[model samples]
Target: METAQNQQQAVCGKEALDLLNCVAQSPYDQEKCVALLQSLRQCVLNKKVKKFSLAEPHKEQADSSMIWSKTETWKWSTKLSH
Candidate 1:
């Protein structure tokens, strides 16, 4: 069940990114794109994706490369001990 939810979140994120790319490629539809962007943001917030953490399991090592940080960026380091 958790895996399914994660997959759903991935789909939503990809769709939002695709919409953003389309907006970037075509500036004439800024209004519509902005509306869609806001909707996507709200959806993500409601789902708490922005609050996701490294504690969550990732399918690939590359997917765990970066972690969200308030002060600085984080990158997975094989050399560092946890």
Candidate 2:
């Protein structure tokens, strides 16, 4: 049982890593990379590593919102100072 579990983990890791490499190689292929990332996320969930949450529908949206908010705050601060 332990060996089987280890093998499954190894396979999942390999698949995720391969997808990452694909994204790295084709940086301009945004759609493909996003699909790969979603697949990787699904793989992790299948391994019971995380729980599904509606708060984070897409990986990019979650990260971009934080970044956008920070940029907006900085802009406001700069304007206030000027």
Candidate 3:
């Protein structure tokens, strides 16, 4: 079970990295990153990725990753619509 979870994390991590790199390369162009963003979103849904954290396991390292769940994404979108 743990192995399967780790695999999923690896896939999601790759997708996240791809999207970040795309955005970094084209900061002013939202259109360019749309496909990569969608790819990451699909991976997140398919893998049931609940959250992502940094590699450092040490408690001293600050975890700055913006962890979000499905509900949180929904709430954020709804706020934008209002």
Candidate 4:
């Protein structure tokens, strides 16, 4: 069970990383990252991933202002409008 969970996390993590890299490389033109973003969204839905941590939290950082901060936990909204 743990192995399966790890594999799912890996898949979603890879997709997310790819999207992040795409956005970083093309900050001015975000259109290029659209496909990558969609891919990550699809992976999240397919894997049924509710929440995932990008990095470990630091003791000093108590602010939750940054959306992509190391302490923030990303959650995927399952409700999609059709």
Scored by lDDT, the top model is 4
Against the true structure, what is every candidate's RMSD? Answer: 10.2, 15.6, 10.8, 7.9
Comparing 2 and 4 on lDDT, the stronger one:
4
Candidate 2 residue runs with Cα over 4 Å from true position? 1-11, 50-82
Predicted candidate 1: what Cα RMSD to the true structure? 10.2
Off by over 4 Å in 3: 1-9, 57-82
TM for candidate 3 is 0.50
Please write out the lDDT profile of model 3 over residues 9-49, one tens digit for every residue.
34366677677667667345787689888998897777776
lDDT per residue for candidate 2 within 5-75, as digits (tens), equals 35333324544555656766744787877888888677766665432222233233211211112223211
lDDT of 4 by residue, 18-50 (tens): 777676673455776888889888987887766
Evaluated at residue 35, the lDDT of candidate 4 is: 83
Q: What does the lDDT come to for candidate 4?
A: 0.54
- Model 1 residue 23 distance off true place after TM-score fit, in angstroms: 2.1
Please give the lDDT score at residue 4 for candidate 2: 44
Lowest summed lDDT across 10 adjacent residues in model 1 is found at 73-82
Question: lDDT per model, in order?
Answer: 0.48, 0.43, 0.52, 0.54
> Candidate 3: worst 10 consecutive residues by lDDT?
73-82
